[model samples]
Target: MTTITTNPFPVNHPLTFHRVAQPSPPTPFNSANSKHNTHPLTAYTYSTKHAEPKLSATSHEDQPLLFLLRQRKTEEAWLTYSQSTRLPGSTCLSRLVCQLSYQNTKEGFTRAQTIIQRLRDERQLHRLDANSLGLLAVSAVKAGHTLYATSIIKSMLRSGYLPHVKAWSAVVSRLAASGDDGPTEALRLFNSVIRRVRRVADPAIAADARPDTAAYNAVLNACANLGNTGKFLQLFDEMPEFDVKPDVLTYNIMIKLCARADRKDLLVFVLDRILDEGIDPCMTTFHSLLAAYVGFGDLETAEKMVQAMREGRRDLCRILKDSNWENSENADEVFVKLLPRSKISSDHDPPLLPKEYAPDSRIYTTLMKGYMKEGRVSDVVQMLEAMRHQRDSTSHPDHVTYTTVVSTLVKAGSMDRARQVLAEMARVGVPANRITYNILLKGYCQQLQLEKAKELVREMADDASIEPDVVSYNILIDGCILIDDSAGALAYFNEMRTRGIAPSKVSYTTLMKAFALTGQPKLAHKVFDEMLKDPRVKVDLVAWNMLVEGYSRLGLVEEAKKIIQNMKENDFYPDVATYGSLANGIALARKPGEALLLWNEVKERCGQKKVEDSSSSAPPLKPDEGLLDTLADICVRAAFFKKALEIVACMEENGIPPNKTKFTKIYVEMHSRMFTSKHASKARQDRRMERKRAAEAFKFWLGLPNSYYGSEWRLEPDDGDDYSTDSF
Candidate 1:
């Protein structure tokens, strides 16, 4: 018998087992024990051949949280950390934060916020290093929590931690894209962050946090959007200080700024500057240039620019220089200084564009919009056809191009053609978005085609699968007003809310307009009140004017005056529309005294300038023909000839000719026999003479013969003895 002294099985083998051989009997095991005793008689022997229970690889406490995170088991990982007594490592926590933020869901963001709050409470926020904080911030921005991302970066800055350029740039870009005061906030945030970076002691951290080209572009874009030309120039100049060279996008943003500032002369110079800087222009540069020209109502210039692109002529600077741009001489001095020196002073100059730019769908669409603006419907249609025939797919008409065609047709009162275009869109497989449908709906509403508008709305939902948004309901409400159906307007407004679509400012204002048009002033007031209560909508000037119109239409002059007072209190001055409505109200109420007062205020607001003097500066209040006419009508009806003459003079000064024919007709019908009585007392004659002189002057201005000797008159005795005058 061989006695194996050492254990035959490996200690760490899975199947290894240890057991003591049962001592059968002292006499039976004597020889075996004696043989094993030579190697120091073993108390136990191990064997791998026998089956044994498997041991766990690791304990629960030893499990890695990051492993769960890698499996995307975020919730489980978090739960495990919460249940454990020891906190996870900093790397694990940072990964958890980043993963939660990247989920991009509302719940995900909320949970991320909760995690941050827990860290702050535990004084463990420092565990998340600067790099991890930056990732979290960028992730938050991607998840649509821009403000939250901004807060995160701000917290980092406050804690003497500098964020990466990507983190702050993303936030700035998002803020610049928002409406209202978002651009201003973006500028403020950029200034603060940049200040912090400049003050950093460590060169490495400063370099990482320093605003790069993208960061500068973002803040410059914000400045452009705000129309702060001075701020834009300041920031643009600062780019060189930061050692950041301006790219093509920087010039693109500069073009937009010039457009907003109405400095068309600077546009070409900007292109020249781009070329001088050795930067290639992008497609957006061309589109922005065309759009700028179109916005200025300079379709001639816009068309020329597009033609230059089509003909592969890059001498845009030379072309624009030779052409007569209206606002060229009036360019802002500061802006002009920033542009590169113009080389196209003489007609012969090199092309600014380095390469031939082919007109794409967007470029074509921009030119089409210019044609649409000028009411060149045929040109717009021809352009659309031209786009369809283009071999290059980039130049082919897309949905926006088609939508422009539809808008042009609608504006031309060609609803039939517009609807046909919609069909063509479907046939061509270019799906019409809500904007296209809304344009059609607005056209129908403007034409008072309520039934057609309603049908179109249903078609949008049932066929196009495009739900009618708030704009659709707003259009429907205005259409209802056109058909004198205030109840219909209210129903549509309610339906919009019931469908969970929030009411926009247009919706509220439009519904208020419905009530105002139907002579329901009180109901209009209620609508206005509801609008004030709606946080989603702000009461704009149009809404206030509608309220004023509601009251004034019913001859509620006092109430209208009160509303105007409220309008002033709300920082909304009385515009021409407001005064026009009030004037109509005054006419209805027959309050000539109020007319005189309103004229005084209007004259002051208009600066009482003559048409010849209007070239110097724009009047604070541009005179409206309708408002002046309404005021003049009131004065003539009340036989206030002096006040009527004043209003007519103001009209002529504003270049709105007085309605001499209407005034002549009024005089013949109402005041032909005025002051023709004889035998009046001295005092009474003196009192009547002033009005008589004013009437004669007005008749003279109207090119009418003097009433004193123009025609034969029969006199009768006056009934009232106070004046003792004969009536004619």
Candidate 2:
């Protein structure tokens, strides 16, 4: 007998077997060996070499890590991973990183960064392949870590790894949509990708890394949003060089750029360019055109454009073209002539939209908003009804359209009708979102219906499943201010924070206004300090103005001035509202010299040749009638006639006609009897004479008779002797 030596299992293992060879030739069962053969040990033999036992890929070493990750026990999972003798497989490690990134928490992002850094330190970053890094970038973006996502993409590029288009494109798109230097960063990332493509030696890698049409669209959108017309043109010109073509979306973005730049004259030419490029116009194309017209407050042209769409007119461009550009005799001809030939073509061709674009709900709502802007309440309501009657489902009024109707009604003080519209929204099975509820809240608050506003808040939570956001709270706070309920404003402010709704800049400012209006300047200051400490809310000029108003309302002129000085040191120039509040404070405090100083500062700011002039370091201030009148009233009360005359002249220059009748009343009530008493000294007589001459000049401007005086008798010089104070 022979024994087989090969065995797949190790020695001493449970599955290990030791067996003698079977009989070489056929043999009958014998009783002597039957006992040994009873166990039926079948011998298995290998033809070549011994084979190793096959185990599951994820069953053994990665099981613990996978289990912890699956249970979301990331901390425990990392601990197990760190104590491991060897690193996990690339797929396992990549999954760990992805799971960490997907957590979307600060700790999760920090942990993910730590893992990547560990890999780099250990020279094991190669475990994470291109796909893995690309996924990480996308995950970071979803977590709101856009800058971190951008860094991940840059790392991929540096490693000669071409990330998926979705990864980099998403990063660029998110960055562009973000505020501040986001758009600039988006452009820089796009350029980096482009440069990376150029440096790649392999055609396959270059093609993979090359910015696609979507990437170009994203960066172009950034350019448009940044209002970089020159850069927009430059990037657009570069598209064709990279074998990328502008699609309908590209033209739509260009239309937005035109609107933002206020080059309304170029809007039609953009549509012409779209048709020229043979790109079929989408609904967004028409919407952009209509929105551009509406935003520029050219409702007449906007209505005409909408009418053209309703009539299915093919000559949309002709119907909506700027007449100022067509008429060569127009005064703006020189301005139009200076536009770039590419952006605005002088050729008056018959530019027509190739296809008809029927107006949708958005288009109708945009038109309604324009009507709302002009306070044309009836027109906005008619537009809403028109949307409802349309046969197309796309034209049916949705939540936004209904909201516009509500807004129009609210603006017209038709609160009862606005409430009915909300009911209509529910009847039509259209869900009113938080914005719709907030609008109603604001209207109720403005109307001083605090009870109704509070009821609406409850209804939002119970019936609509809509919780009050910061705006809702802000409106309620402002309503409290309107009703002089500072306590109620404080209650709403505190409730919003308790409900996990962080206070915004508007919220803080509105609350401050409540305290300020109620003569609680100290409380307003407390709120201002809290706003400064809040990292989520940015303290803007409005907030600063609110702080000043708070102190000014209490006649705290010194405190208000200190706040204004701080406002300036922070690079925020006092606007009309700021100065107006300060003027009120000065008037309340009865400080004439402070009013004089304020007038001087205001004149300096208002005296600039142009508000947009580059040489001016501070924004030009255009004093409103309220501010001017307040200062003038203060001057008249203090008998500063010369300063008051200068203020009135400024008012006339700015097209704000001075209230001569009101100023005359103030002069008669306060300063009419001034200099009537006899002066003892020659110097006092000369000073009084100087005041009398200035008062007479002011009187001349007011069209008052030279002989007019208050109830007291007039003081006249006797026979051209100026020093004589003779009462007539």
Candidate 3:
């Protein structure tokens, strides 16, 4: 047996504590100390600092009362006892632990944290024993206060008190699992603990300080959360050096990381190593691998992996039976009783076999999600059927199962089939959720069937009792806009507001777009103004772009420019669409010079201009194909042939293909100018003579002797016709 070292602080330390000095507030200084002061200056200095309160010795009579309160496990009464008897800090700390222990409610947890902070502020934190602090740490983890938990552990460790393994694991795991700033903080704490453990000279102290597998796994989790694949792999390799062998969770974390990094080779290598080392792969292990294969489009391998999982489930049942768990109907029924709710839906529902199985609904749901990703409707259908038919598996279809199926079908453009799946869900006692209904609504709207979408919304309210949320109305408005039903969109928008459902940013943007396309530019502006006035709605670039596009479409060049300037004033740079819209508007209005200026500004903004261009100092914007095409068309219309050709070259340099029709139009126009030029007359006459000779030759070949060979084929004397200016 491993003998634990003696604790520096006993679990039942005396409540007596010496009061520490608390810093006082700053005092107001007087001018009397200044050497430059005039002759007779009397000044008084008021010091806010007060003397430290003396410590009170422990009362022997109060100890019995504190013990009685602790014995009865009455935390509230302990609080009253501490106040009445002036018990030691140890009693206060014990009361705090008790408060945190029974804190199952959210409000109770909040009160516990408040008490912990209050004790720290009062300089009573030193009275906490290692065990009491450990309990506090665990409570912090349970309450999701990872930072508080880490702070508690760090304070105890700094005081040379080593926390138990469970405490360390709880704090580390909470920090690692937190997806926010927790991962970064978790790494910092892990490093601190590791360094402290390494610095300790005593072997016994070091043993208590050294992190175990759980602590290491927490760090691994942090690395995984941050997607630091390189760091994760490095630490994974170093686990053996730390005398912490990889457990099932270690492999599971590695597999998940590998899946995210798309390191298929590494994932396979780890799984194979697990098998070689006789480490049984848990459900998470297989789930991670299966998700990876499905994500990478290796559906065949994923299907086989699912089959292997099923076999593993059967093997688990056999092992359990051989272990005498299945000796009688009621022998050791823990396994069957502890089956996940996902496996067996209701309490009254019986397990499929004499015992529970491992390949429950989650595995099937995971596979269904993979199929959804691959868009394999047929395979998803087959899997659903397999779940329904599996005799020994109580984990047949659930709500998640039906929802995944419905969403997949909707994405595949199968609305009718999706509705049928929803009906099937209802038949299987799995009611359709908001997500399921929303998917169907989106499907209908995507097909431009707004009437069907409206009917679906009505059905949701009338039959399903699910209110049409902001998202539902947003989709409906967008659907109306798709088929140019502006009035319909507005009606829905008004109805949404009347129904007390606030329009989201998407709602406003979609409505703006609808108004813009219908030539209601002013209405679009009104919509934007309303969004700005509403405190809940913060207008984004998409909203501004839609309004700008509306004005530009109506040849409101100045209005569009003002919108861009306003956007700049708001610290938002104009994107390619904004710049392109303005440029096209200016060009169409026949302001070539202004259009060229706008294009140069656009090039500078998009980082397309040479460094020599004066306006290249602004932050870069992303240039899209539409912007380039607009500039090229503007140049073509302006008859800046040389500049037009330069624009084409710029387009080629930027890998933006020139618009063929627009380029050909410019090319023909350039040649027309050349045809009318004095130097090209001789070349043009030669081309005309070549065509005439070829026509005569073709006539001779056809044996039409009465053609150009006769006197009727006289060349009309250079009489200027419509082609005179164009001809040589």
Using lDDT as the measure, the top candidate is 1
Q: Any runs in candidate 1 off by more than 4 Å, and if so which?
A: 1-101, 105-212, 215-228, 297-304, 311-316, 319-331, 608-619, 676-681, 687-689, 705-728
Q: Best to worst by TM-score, what's the order?
A: 1, 2, 3
With a 3 Å backbone cut-off (N, CA, C), the pairs that clash in candidate 1 are none
Winner by TM-score between candidate 3 and candidate 2? 2
lDDT of 2 by residue, 190-240 (tens): 888777666655544444456678888899899889987777777777877
Model 1 Cα lDDT, one tens digit per residue, 1-728? 11111221112321211212221111111233332332111111123464533432434453578688767787787777778777665556666766666565656566666666666556566555454556666766776656667776666655555566777788888889877667998999899888876665554435656688999999989988989988998898888767898899988998888888867767777877887788888899889888988988888888888899889998887787666434445456667667745423444354578889989999999989988988999999999999999989999999999999999999999999999999999999999999999999999999988888889988998999999988889889988888899999999999998998878888888888888988898998998898888654557889999999999999999999999999887878888999999999999887888998999888877874544445423247897899999999988878888889999998998899888999889877777666756656788789888787888887778777765557543234354333212211
In candidate 3, which residue pairs get closer than 3 Å at backbone N, Cα or C atoms, i.e. clash? Answer: none
lDDT at position 310, candidate 3: 72
TM-score list, all predictions: 0.75, 0.74, 0.54
Q: Kindly report which residue pairs in candidate 2 clash with one another.
A: none
Give a tens-digit lDDT track for model 3, residues 1-728: 11112222233442222222211111111123634321111111123364424545435754654565546544554455546634355544454454454444555555555555555556465554455566667776786556667766776665555565567667888888765467778878777767666665554544544567877888988887777766676666666755888788887787666666645534554554455457776767766766776677766666665665576543322222222221223322222221222122223222112222257776788878888887889988888888888765546878778888888888999888888998888787778878778888989999988788888888888887988888888888889999998999999999999988778889999999999998888999999999997654568888889988888888888898889889988977888778877776776576677767776776566554445555544566667777777776665555444455556666777788767665555434432232232344676777655434433443343243324656433223233332322211
Q: What's the residue-level lDDT of 356 in candidate 1?
A: 91
Worst 10 residues of 3 by lDDT: 21-30
